[model samples]
Target: MANTTVPEVFATETPEATVEIDAGAGKHVEPMLWGLAPYQWVSISMLVLLLFAFFGAKVHKTIAGGLDGKIAAIKQQLDEAKQLRAEAEALRKEYADKIAGAEKDAEAMLENAQHEADAILEKAEADSKAMVERRKRMAEDKIAAAEREAVEDVRNRAALAATSASRKLIGEKHDAEADKALADKVIAGI
Candidate 1:
């Protein structure tokens, strides 16, 4: 065996001197258990745990079943949502139809009311015209009656004046002799 000194360089501002000895060079040994290295044993242990979970615990089946259940729940929820949407659409259509019907009914009612109003107006106009005609006729009849009454009064007054004048003339012209001669003539003629 021989000892040798070697100079080593460091990243810092320092140099180191190391002693080299030939002691089992190029031959290495690592600690192992069951003919496996530490890292290999760790890998084997992880594989064993996975196998145990798969077979003994049935963890994969449980996980898959849980995921399947969640999927089924989601599908059910989607179906319910679709049903609700369909119902909503039906209700909306029904309401829309009802609104349309209501609008039509309102239009009909409005038209009917307009017709009635027009009829009433026409009737009122006719009634007013008839009333005016009747009043005019009545006034004409009254005027005719008044004229007839005035003519009758005038005729009666004239007749009374003529009778009085004739009586006065007879009394003034026929004296006692003329009255006796008129009487004798009327007796001889008879």
Candidate 2:
């Protein structure tokens, strides 16, 4: 087969060679370093510049829009805070009203309790006074009855003594009918 080489297909080949004949040149031989060519670097830089030009406007716009979005978010939060403050104020007012109502209710309850207590006390005092009056009337009636009984006893003792003395002096026995008549007359006169 014929010898094949890649140089046969190249349109152009530029090879650079350097030869050192002197012995005093550097003791170590430096190998050839491979790197990007000047033209490749320039082309890459040009491509990067084109890419930046093409998409830079959009990126700048996106960044500006993102900043505006952040500002809008902060404004929304501020509005929410204002709304929350208003709600809190409303709640506070409502709570204050409830507290006032509760206080009024408590005061009314206390007044009612005081009135009830006064009524009960008045009733108890009235009952006690009535009981005392009733007891005094009963005691007075009992005393009058006792005095009547004592007077009756005294009259009965005097009549008995008079009858006994008469019976002894006269030496006579009285019939039941006569004695009853006399006793009746004496009792009636007394």
What is the clash count for each candidate, in the order shown? Answer: 0, 0
lDDT of candidate 2 vs native?
0.83
Whole-model lDDT, model 1: 0.83
Q: Please, what's the RMSD in Å of model 2?
A: 12.3
TM-score of each: 0.51, 0.57
lDDT of 1 by residue, 21-41 (tens): 346665333455545566889
Assess candidate 2 and give its TM-score to the true structure.
0.57
- Cα lDDT tens digits for candidate 2, 1-190: 9878667433122333222235686543222224455466778899999999889988989999999999999999999999999999999999999999999999999999999999999999999999999999999999999999999999999989998888886556667787789899999999
List the lowest-lDDT window of 10 residues for candidate 2: 11-20
Report every candidate's CA lDDT: 0.83, 0.83
- Candidate 1 least-lDDT 10 residues: 11-20
Model 1 Cα shift for residue 59 (angstroms): 3.8
Q: Which stretches in model 1 have alpha-carbon errors above 4 Å?
A: 1-52, 55-57, 145-190
